[model samples]
Target: MKFDPNSNLVYSTDTGRISPSQVEKVIPEGDGIIRIHKESKGRKGKGVSVIKGLALDEKNLKTLAQKLKKQCGCGGTVKDFNIEIQTDNRELLKSLLEKLNYTVKLAGG
Candidate 1:
């Protein structure tokens, strides 16, 4: 990540900046912030995992996913507009991101 002191904005080497316009969480019908959940759709069916929230792009998502993957000692990646992890450590990830002012919600599960 790159920090432009003049603008007081922290920039990512990939996503450039962590701005509100860069992150988005879609709420399904009858869902609110706390209703968020992690979703996994394998070859079988969709299962709810431990996901706090989601980011919108590969650049920002990859950076965040990498950090979580490292901390959790697992593998994770960014695909489409979703950040997917191989472990079930959403609580840890939530705390880490909260330090960066990212909002988190537990949905579905």
Candidate 2:
């Protein structure tokens, strides 16, 4: 078989698809403060504590979310780099975050 330098390899029987090079994940930069707020806007009056401004990546965020949920004894999730806990205990969240050396502030009403 003659090797062509200008030829591009699209696929091969050994490999199902030729994927592009992996791109680095870009984490959003945050200020030196984390905000904990209560949001019940679209949740039909069931408020959830939203924690934002953490400078951690997705995996770390999820880990932190799990820890927070365990500590709060409630369910939560990490969405868009923000932690949403199914509880209105923003004070508990603030204290927990502060214990971890994060500057947390209660935002919103």
> How good is model 1 by TM-score?
0.52
Q: List residue ranges in candidate 1 displaced over 4 A.
A: 1-36, 40-56
CA lDDT, every model vs. true structure: 0.58, 0.89
TM-score to true structure, per model: 0.52, 0.77
Instruction: Give the runs in model 2 whose Cα sits over 4 Å from its true position.
Output: 1-25
The count of residue-pair clashes in candidate 1 stands at: 4
Going through the candidates in the order shown, the clash numbers are 4, 0
- Candidate 1 per-residue lDDT over residues 46-94, each given as its tens digit: 4434443453445666787788778778876665555666755567766
lDDT of 1 at 14: 92
